[model samples]
Target: MPLLQRWRQAISKMSSASPSRFAVLVFTSIIFLWSLLLTLPISSADGTPTRYLDALFTAVSTICVTGLSTVDMSTHWSPFGNVVIFLGIEVGAIGVLTLASILGSVVTRKLGLRQRLIAASDGNALRLHRGAVSESQAVRLGEIGGMLATVALSLIIIETIIALFILPVFWASDLVTHWWDAVSYSFYYSASAFTNTGFAPNPGGVPEFADNGWFLGCLAAATFLGSLGFPVLFSLVRWARDRSKRPGVHVKLTLAATLVLFVLGALTLWLLESGNSDTFGSRTPIEGLLGGSFLSVMARSGGFSTIDIDAMNDSSLLVLDALMFVGGGSASTAGGIKVTTLAVLFLAAVAEARGSSDLQLFRRRIPHDVLRLAIAVALWGAMVVGVSSILVMSLSGAGMREAIFDTISAFATVGLSTGLTESTTPAAQLVLAVTMWLGRVGTVTMAAAVASSERKQLYRLPEERIIVG
Candidate 1:
């Protein structure tokens, strides 16, 4: 039997377990399988076997849609390895529960209870803190089929369109020496950008396309669309098809926060670095503006860069760190606390400051449950970053700035690094690897898996006032 089938058999045995556990298992299995595949001599350019630890880290990063890598992808990996990495990214981007649903659909054309639970939890972005949904809320046969179909088709259509648009640029530039290389690079980068993975096979990466207007345009568009989240994308498609269809609260909040953050980040970067020769100062006016906008787009989870990340001013780095921590929309390829969460958290605070009873956003009254979720996710993420930073500091002897930046990058799954990732020791690297996994898997899911199995209360206890902040 195939290796995947064997894993399937094992996972089936755990069918009775929580969907969160199942999800963690599936992702863990993929990392292990891919790492083993990457260990083969054929996977590397030099015809030598890739080290197990390096291969494992690469597998985790790729599968997590985190672009952090111990290996220089262009020089170290052969075409075969690149293809393997691409496949891993694709699967990872689709997500663990969703991927299982896809496979189950292909094989059985029907889903079991386990598949239904996983699909619903992932599809609706269920917050386990609020507890799982009812059986009826779990995706039905028809809805699951439609959701998976729409997601797959949307990804294919978007990637194809972006790839076609970029192919000519690759053909025109010094980036591609051969027709096949152009084709491959076009497809890979298109998928990578759309998935928010930001793993460019090109050695020079985004810098090579810095002045290429068409390439940058396509890339930015792809990244924006991808980071918008599948729910928002699907809702937009529905609205496009039928005027009566309206976007959900999540979609509205995500788009608004994303737009605001994008402009804010762009303006901040331009103001801070436009005079710094190491960053935007040396570039032309148009290049600097465009480059700053690109950096803004990338700050919210996409890791592509046109300038030296290490050379940025302290203020710019702080701004970027803040942006990266906020990340993209929930259920998107991008990581961090998610834009909606941040937006809601901010709105909640504003409402409290105004002494308003309800947290209203865009005239919609947000739920207390969702506000609690936002608070929990943010606090948990901060704690993870804090602990990871201290660990990196103690293990690798990195200063506060380097430790915080590296830890945040890993935790956000935003691969932009300072000059630190390469020189970090194995313990530091391991810390980062774990941080990447947790960030991608998410604190919400981890919370769900670990939350006690005690029964829900029939009634709440009497409320008591707490101290103010």
Candidate 2:
């Protein structure tokens, strides 16, 4: 074939492929390209060529917005390297297919029908033909452009406000003596917190300001907003402007579940660790409460930590594992199976208990397929975490507690650690990196990618009831 013909054919094939697969390809390409950039001598602080494994690990972590690192992120990289990390997380923070939508609009000068479907599918998996969405849960095709704009605007405005919140805190603290240093730290924390990537530019990380309740509060607030997801934020903005317009079912569920989880996690942690000298027991009751609250927020995919992960009791670690796995809202920078999935599962259990046939919530009937998708996502997330945890333990000889904690952290993109990741073998690091990638790409998207070529069946199957569990 002629070169032009071949190029056209290639483009056509890719365009015809599943959007989920295309998203995976884009993520992989970004990781590879960033890996190469990070491996350059200029990326290192001492002008040495960094190991490809470490570079690749950092690239995956940064691109996945997972804060786990194999090296000292604060001092290992030069100024150029830091910039690369910053931009990489920001790019990754925008959610994969959403970024594609923005780029598509830029390249095509407008969003075609197909492009809108891709963006809509990013926010609403129901758009992928998996199932029907309730009116409240669906984003109309015509509204995609506006939704995209909301995403961009929310990120900028929220991050800027968060940075302003952090700027004065940094200035009051002894950490920085110069104006630029305070500004840089403030903005870095802003991006990191909002992106839910817990990379600190300083050596000691956020713990340096451990006593600064105001700073921790700001970080927690930024993370909570990020975890709310773009769709919820868009709905919130609309509702705020017009009080008569109530938020959608999705927005309600996400907010309600998140608030519930945050409060429960905080109380559970405080109750469990308040007596331990290492985590919160050494502090006053109020101080302990604050620390527990901060840790709880981090567990919701914020990735920032003020308390010591190693000193916490094993029971506390188990609680964190559950919180991290549940993670944040759908279509958000936060990872894991997502709060919406958990909410659906919980509702399904309630309906089953009540002998109700329909999965009802907020006076709306959630389709059976949405339940199936939720179950599939949860199972797939578990499968990934289970398999990766086993591999990590086998390769690193880490204790079950340590291995599982780090693995869940990677799979959830939570970024909490038992201090095992940095000390693990390269093979284990590779496994965790893959976990981060899977977590960030999402289990539902991965499933859709794998089964993208499946066709619909015209005939209905005979209904047979299976025995109850």
Candidate 3:
């Protein structure tokens, strides 16, 4: 009876806690538990023991969707470890809040207020306003789960079909010798590529076929699709299904902005690396163009690369830093400030250029709250990257560019590296880990937690202006 009373009290306390604090507590607890599970000594196929640090690193990487690895994933982990990683990616990409909501629906056959709040915060709700939808929360959660399952299953099926065609090409070129190995390799590559988790199972890392025009092209396309965010993909599908009806302005602007970024990124990389023989090295003009195009698309979000990132010229590295900073589409698998946020900021800049007070895109005015959120995300991301870079540089003695690149990779959860992660110190690794966690949960959630304790202002202050730049 005493124990039951204590349990009820605990539940009451949790129920009364601020949502942001509750979220953080839940996230931390889950991550710690997962880390502990991974830290247990696990045997690989060859009977080699996995180290605690390696396991912890891998666990953090999987949970955060950050691909920095202290050890080779393919050779180090047994099938069990691989399964753990696969599950981690699924959960991490789907998000903790969404998973909780789904689980709540399954267990209770209904969704509570807490679950609905989480769903809204996760961007699953069609309208942010309370009581905008008449359906039960359980229905909404079930729909979200169904959507996730359908998307994941579709990705696997499509990748498997694509792999069947790709395997023959790999086999013909002697890239993969055996059929089973090829199949496993193809499946792993497809999963890693789609999740933007850059962990390759290949013994030699990304195979030489990565340099092949067709292979690079296919991989780039797959990564781009994966990084474009689920919300945007669903929107596109719905719009396509109902083409007679006009698409939302957000959908139109997202697609336009995506194309613009791709083109601009490609041009920047081409011009920056045109003279560098190491990255564009000794290649025919066509090859250089192909490589540059691939880098432009892949560097922003996906971490896979045909060319050695470490070998790139300084100018090219700076270009990559910029692209990585901007990142992929909003609400997508990829991370960064997000393309939509950047688009909004760009539109805001244009509005200022036109000497207009209102920011507009696609003939639609963006809400001030949304603009503030975008700025907050950008600021937080930049600060995380900057602070992480400082910590890494201090600990590892790595060059500024290398440290910056690694920090951006961690914060964006892109997983691309210039060969610095392998040599980073323990302290530096911790910094990267924190950055990954922040990048995954994002700035808005963190900001919410910090502001939760502050009381809301019931009265408005008179408007005042400071000097502008």
Candidate 4:
């Protein structure tokens, strides 16, 4: 074909494809390219090249911000390799949020009905019914830039502050020989924890400062903020700037869900692991409580843990699984079905049980369509975790519970593990890699439904009564 014909064909194809599909391709290409670079000998420790599958696993996990790794960061990779991984993660995080915002912003943009609906619903910011928006809504590309700048600058500032707060602790611990190295590690961990990427450069995950209340607390603060989603951040920033009256329903719900889950997970972990030999074992009350709280936030998609997750009691692991599966707030760095989704589901169920005609929340009527979307996202996520669990067990010879735990870690992109990730078979690792991608890109909003066409409800069929359960 002629060059003009080829350019026209490319433009036509992109015009027809959904933004989500294009985003997936872009992210996938990023993962693939990063994987190859990571496999280079210069990227590995001891000057030996990394294997294809393991390198691929690391690339996908890092880019997806899921910390499940086939190799230890400190021992397996050189400093060069670490830099590569860091850059990959930064890009991946930006890509995920930026693409999500694109559906919310595109200039000269003609979008399908379904695409617009997704834009309204799948925002990092909760749209509180802005006057029946459709094609009538203005598509301003500048909206994308503003949102991206807000998210990026906020993250940088938060991470910088966190790094400063914890740098003294890191240096005092004498973990690193050089001051510069300590500074680098502090910033890296701060960024990783806040971004919820969970990659630890330390061999034992900063055990030197693990018990330091100040260091852990700083990270906890960063993780909490990062997991609240960009929408929440934007709301806070805007409120600060313009003296906004109140937060939107989405921000309100996200904050509430995040707080409730953090407390719940912390309490549960403390109860379950404070006495256990493997985790929080023989620790003082204060230490145990603090450690539990830290792990709980990590479980909520932060991915950093003070203790060996593998040694925790099965019950604690189960709780972690639930926390990881629920993940964090929508449009946030965290993954899973999202806390708001779970919250909305519970609220809907409560309303239904009370025989309410409409799902009422925060003094507003919750649309049935939004409720269905939540249900669909949750169901799709559960199905993905379920199938991946079965395959992981079959391929890796891991026990059923362990399989499920790891599967949730990958699928939610939570990155917590039971020491099974590294030992798992190649095919199982591939399953997890794919799961991480799906979870990070958003399994529900970014994959199938986003790619699907919109159907119009023009004519209604003859009404018929059907039996209900």
Q: Which is the leading candidate under TM-score?
A: 2
TM-score attained by model 3: 0.87
- Each candidate structure's count of clashing pairs: 0, 0, 2, 0
Per-residue lDDT tens digits for candidate 3, residues 259-359, read 88888878778777778877775777777777778887777677887778888888788888988888876656677887877887887888889999998
* lDDT by residue for model 1 (187-251), tens: 99988888888788989788877777788889889888888877677777767787776676767
- Clashing residue pairs in candidate 2 (N, C-alpha, C atoms within 3 angstroms): none
Stretches of candidate 1 above 4 Å error? 1-13, 103-109, 112-114, 127-142, 447-455, 458-462
User: For each candidate, what is the lDDT?
Assistant: 0.80, 0.86, 0.68, 0.76
TM per prediction: 0.92, 0.95, 0.87, 0.89
User: What's the alpha carbon RMSD for model 4?
Assistant: 4.0
What's the distance in Å from true for residue 420, model 1? 1.1
List the RMSD of every prediction in angstroms. Answer: 3.2, 2.1, 3.9, 4.0
Span of 10 residues, lowest total lDDT, candidate 3: 130-139
The CA root-mean-square deviation of candidate 3, after full C-alpha superposition on the true structure, stands at: 3.9
Which residue segments of model 2 deviate by more than 4 Å? 1-13, 130-135, 447-455
